[model samples]
Target chain A: MGDALLEVKDLVVEFKTRRGALRAVDGVSFALKPGEVLGLVGESGAGKSLTGAAVIGLLEPPGHIAAGSVTLGGERIDTLPREAMRKVRGKRIGMVFQDPLTSLNPLYTVGEQLTETIRTHLPVNQAEARQRAIDLLNDVGIPAASRRLDSYPHEFSGGMRQRVVIALALAAEPEVVIADEPTTALDVSVQAQIISVLKNLCTEKGTAVILVTHDMGVIAETADRVAVMYAGRIVEIGPVRDVIKQPVHPYTMGLMGSIPDPQGGAERLVQIPGAMPRLNAIPVGCAFNPRCQMAIDRCRVERPTMRRIGATDVACHVAGPAETTP
Target chain B: MLAFLIRRVFQAVIVMLTVAFISFSLFRFVGDPISTMVGQDATIADRQAMARELGLDQPFIVQFWRFIAKAVQGEFGISYRVGRPVMDLIQERLPATLELAFCAAIFALVFGIFFGVYTALRRDSWLTKVVMTVSLIGVSLPTFLIGIGLIYLFSVELKWLPSFGRGETVKIGGWTTGFLTESGLKSLILPTITLGLFQMTLIMRLVRSEMLEVLRTDYIKFARARGLSDRAVHFGHALKNTLIPVITIMGIKLGALVAFAIITETVFQWPGVGFLFISSVQSVDVPMMASYLLLVALFFVIVNLTVDLAYFAVDPRLRISAVATRG
Candidate 1:
């Protein structure tokens, strides 16, 4: 926490629509420490994935970072030139896409893809790069890694292909990896396996991970800290245990309630009333005010900034004062 | 790989046989070859003797079988117009057509791919707009009209090149090639453009669209995410995927160029097989017509086989699946 490896301050992501510019990620901010796993949890369209993409400078055209800075190791990376940013991509920050099937080029062998990536970032010859690729596949727990190197993406099953993707992301041994819904497209049984492989590999390499997902259960199992986002903003962020046990923001409370309690028999899951507002139609103040169960008059009129409350930082006027938490 | 080739060859044989059958039928129904061969002075008895000698009096199936047998041996009897062996006539004309089609193909593929890739990568540039407009014009204009336009521009107005003919050709063995001499290459410019314009535009549009589609795929995005250089991403990955479908189209288009170079050849008087076929049609030369039909079918089959092999080379998925199915 003292020396954050990756720091994102006041990040703003906006898309230029025909009507006007719509803010998709509105002034979201977070910091990641080395060897730490930070989970970004939100429903679809909440800007969680956009936040991750912005950090690595991979936001698609027509969408861009409007204002704010992404700093890595005391240098502002968000403003670097295209070529320099590209070098920093797999060299400093790796990324894993959602679908394993589409992430790999079907024309090339996995070995060719992996070795090419390795050579792109590292000052290594072909032989060295291939050796490193083999080691990487082995680290990701693929069986017969050497034999499987020449196999194409279609040769592997969904789960195995994801493992290959993880290997590819970690090929350069970057300081940070942005895994956006890495396991979302996998089977339930295989999802845990991928997560465990990801967790173990990142932990072993001492690399920080920004895990963006909608599954709170995954966050509970993997993340040391968690940020709960809603309507393109972080409503609450703190250690996983503290936020899950004692959620200060009403949105976080509703999110926690929705997860069925396996131990508590015959209890219905909680459903939050109303959907998240579209980017253009977000409420005037505290974007979540329309669906908030504990919204006060101030919550609707004056947008609440994140205030330190105990160990957690929450953005809600109705939440108790900072000094009230033990 | 061997199995695939064997299957393709077998299919090619069936296609050739079918094409041969149709041409054989055309020989029987179309005007009398004896009437065209003997001129207006022959008596009824003489015409009957000639028909019998030519095996035209035999049953249709027996005549067809004889045609097939002679065709298999690269013999197509005698041409009514040329009064020489049909095979020898085609042999003399085939080289000119092959050279023309070859040059046109090179022109079309090189410029088509270049323009396609350029426009796709620079979709919003003014140059791209101009290129797209030019391609539209190329696609819509008819071949003969294009040939005449080029002839008007380069020959009529500029007086820079010859309007027709293959120019100075060098004889190498039995093959007469126009590529060796300066005027020959110069003379090829107008007809090549006329013949290749439609194909080039078709290829350009296809490559541009496929390139755009491939650029949007997740693999391309992933390639960029890996910090690959723009060259490696665009050419090495995206372009390879773009070329898969382009290869098949190129094969078909190439076959069409050779088979349907009639208008271009006629306009230029290039002495190619296409020009020969047109004259043979006018003279009702059945043997020449049948031989040309078989040759075009053979060209198509060979091109398709090459396209399939190229698919194996570029795409690992296809290659692996082919092996899997064989196993």
Candidate 2:
């Protein structure tokens, strides 16, 4: 509401598959405020990762932004050319990807890689860059950063390498950081440590973060707000505690119930029936109609618009707070 | 690292001994050298005396061992064709062949890698297509044909270079200044071009394919995502990653350059090891042939060893894996 750092509206991405034009991200919208963390949660093929990629202008070939407005720091980015977009990608918005082992160059030493990134966007000399690289490595909890800087990527364990990747992302000191499945490749213990580091660093620097992940536990731990995506559209969005305690959308409720609690006795995990529809074969009315337990005849005949539900927004036909129900 | 060197040297010695044994046995297969050198018109007594004098009447195994013993002492007897020490003949011609092969390799490697990288960076462009087409033509054509065609263009039509011979020499205190002199370099031009062009085409294609594969890696993507310029991403990151295959091909190509030098020397009549080898074979000069084979084999082994060492310098991962294996 108050000068969001990033505002994405009516974003739609499509791929030209052999069957048809498959809409991967259909009319997805979200915003990130300064110093805020927004969690985007969905299963594989839910288009959550695609939405993140579109914001960073890193969508692979055959998939492209069809209709959208991505405004970063009040500047329209979706319309910018490639060369200009490249400048904004690393200089203004940093990115961390999945699979740290493959993300880092194996031929270069860790220090060389970090220094290269520092020197790329900053006006710094070699010695300054090297020192900054060591400092960043130390800041990320890598022991003896000075001595370990000379080690190559292959020398580090998987968790340590992910830490290095995070260090690289933070080197540019961008206004926003987009992390896509950042901890999916790490162990549970390492995941907690990485999440803490990311949250603390972003809060310290006042950088907005768009954390794309499937693990709801990560959202519970870090995100200020949660956006639930299904079949390429965000179906539910609200404050993290509100969304977790009382999800209005049946799909969101089903997801929250699926996570097994350590305190709970032996109870059957609630699972939403039916698979996500294929992109080229989406249903006519609501995309989630087949899986919705409270779906009425209107839900099967017409798609629902996003309506307000007690300081929350949800795209559902039959369920919402009374004030905004239509 | 020192231990690796010592092991390589020991292996090289074994390889040399094997080559010497095989060459000695193979040379004998062409029939008795003395009988071949001396005509059938010679009298029976003359033949007997000649066989005894040349030690041909001894057992084959004893003669082979004797040959080896003399070879070890650097006494590769006298060449029947040149009537000089086989070592002396080889030493005289070795420089010319080495010079030609060295120049060709340098020319091929520098230009091949450059063109390969350029084409890969500009993939699907007109320049890349033209370069690839030209390289295909160069690779398909035989070196001899290319040599002949170049001589025709440069020596006959253009009159820019001499057709044959080492040309005039200028000696300065036992060192030759004429190697880089105009006339000397002119004589070398055609053969160097012939050898370089063929290998360059091969190496360029190899480098291009390797570069394309390296560019597709996630590390290269990370480099691009780090805001690296295209030059840094292509040359610094992608090219370095592709060098292992390039270095391996370069080593094998260098060894092949020496082999190609033999044929090139024959075609150009530039007085190199290939010319000496051909005449030695024609006159059945066993010691000279044996010496040449051993030297060439030794050169191949050394080139491969140097390449193996270079791999460690280029990629630290190789060094780490090597050390881990040793431990």
Candidate 3:
């Protein structure tokens, strides 16, 4: 953790809704080490994507970082000026999105997009940037990289376009990539290929990755460590294998149970009994107390912060280590 | 592209024919052309002689047939009021109309797109609010009123520019144009602003809205994330996407400019086809009116076709699928 390539500490992202200030990401904290892959697992509205957006300084307005810090290579970045943050973006961090089509501008040739990005962050002229773009296309597994350079994003197939997006993200050779649901919009058959492409490239380049997704299978395959977020906070964090085999938080347990195992046969997949609380309607104490099956009277009035429980960190009165203060 | 062009050209022919017939028939409702042909003191014999000369003595159907024949032969009949061929009159004034339209287009497109991007980028600013309000007024106010207001401000009160005419021209090669001459260029400013104000508002709002939409697209975010400067993101990425539709709209708007120029020319008394058109309308010069309508309609068709073709160059999806899909 001391040498984390990217560090997110107590990050809180808020949205100014018509009703009032709505806290979407409340005191979430995690760090990604050099060359490490951290999978952020959560249900919809879990603030996982918002965390990624905040780190990249694209927390769409009306939404903003209300508090906390994002440090890249030990330099605090969450509060950097717009101009400064823009420099940090492609030069230090790359971002891949949920949809491939949305991630690549349709009007530009893929080569133009890639070269512009390269020339922006790197000290490369046009010819050299183009060469790097071609190299990146080849690295991301696009066939005939040189020929693919002139293609508009739409000219490529869905999987191929996703590869192009990945190429664009990697154009500047940043230290970390925040891939928010990169595989979610791709077909299942192509998802594996994209995931492998992402994994191999990150591995080869020694780049850290923050992969935000709800797909447990993707986490199981690509993540070195996993963080489970629920209602705007990380409910648990540990090695992916440990979290999958023996989840410490009750919400994490429910999520793990919902991932159907083929060997489990014809049994109905287990689903958590209630929905995640709406922001305005979140409980006074523990946000999850209403939905937690093991919630106690104490749990209804007292929120549980992340606490060490065996090998994992868990935020639950019943499951986490004894409350040190109260 | 070949197929698309062929289909569009074929469709254009149908539209021109329909417009030609409608223009020819609409003249009947205005009553008579003779009142415009002769002086008040002229005799019945002089009027009859004029009618015979124009083939007005023939049956309505036969007169229409002769008109059609002359039109097919590319011989627009002599204007009853001016005693000159309608085509000749149009050709003489064509350059002035083209100049007015070209200047207006440049003014509208350049300013509209610039302000649109600026307002979109500064969405929450009070300046943007003021701009939007002014644009609304711009769109609502009639062109003649804008022309009058501009004339009063620049020509009457300020005495900064000429009020009623296109300025001096120097011979450029074999032809002459007011565009290059200093005073002539000054004369264009008021009229261009008046003629282009509505289109400016229209294109400005379109560019702003389109930029706003394109700015929110995932690719724009991706572009910004790539660390491109704010300028690069807006102009390089977002503006290009915004333009595809804007260009299409501009084509239709170019036609509007020509039609709207009629009112603008009348108010400014600028010597353009629109001025000729108004005089022809007043005199009920059927030959001139018919040719003008046809010419305007033809201009719209050709400009729109060019715009449609331009989409292929800007957007590969259209270019590729143009061939993939059947005509």
For model 2, residues B1-327, the per-residue Cα lDDT tens digits are 777888999998899889888988899876566766778788889888977876778887887788778887878777766678988888777778888888899989988999899898888799899999999989999988998888899899999988777776666553433386789887877888888998998889999999989887877777776777777888889999888889998999899898878778888897888888988888788778888888889789999999999999998988987787778
Worst 10 residues of 1 chain B by lDDT: B26-35
Candidate 3 achieves a global lDDT of 0.88
Candidate 2 residues lying further than 4 Å off, grouped into runs, are A16-22, A81-83, A283-285, A289-305, A322-326, B152-179, B321-327
Candidate 1: tens digits of C-alpha lDDT, residues A108-134: 899999999999988999999999999
Taking all chains together, the TM-score of candidate 3 against the true structure is: 0.95
Model 1 compared with the native: what TM-score? 0.97
Q: Residue by residue across B185-285, what tens digits does model 3's lDDT show?
A: 99889989998989999999999999999998988888888899998998988998999989988899978898888988888888888999889888888
lDDT of 1: 0.92
- Chain A TM-score, structure 1: 0.97
Quote the positional error of residue B298 for candidate 2 in Å: 1.2
lDDT of 1 by residue, B1-327 (tens): 898789889999999999999988976777888888898999999999988988889998998899899988878888878889999999999998998898899999999999999999999999999999999999888889999999999999999999999999999999999999999999999989899889999999999999999999988988888889999999999999999999999999999999879899999998999999999888888888999989899999989998998888888788777878999
The reply for model 3, stretches above 4 Å from the true place, is A320-326, B39-48, B170-176, B325-327
- Tens-digit lDDT track of model 2 for A108-226: 99999999889888999999999999998988889999999999999999889988988898898888889999999998889998888888888988888999999999999999999
Span of ten consecutive residues with least summed lDDT in model 3 chain B: B169-178
Candidates' DockQ values? 0.82, 0.63, 0.80
Clashing pairs in 2: none
- lDDT assessment of candidate 2: 0.86
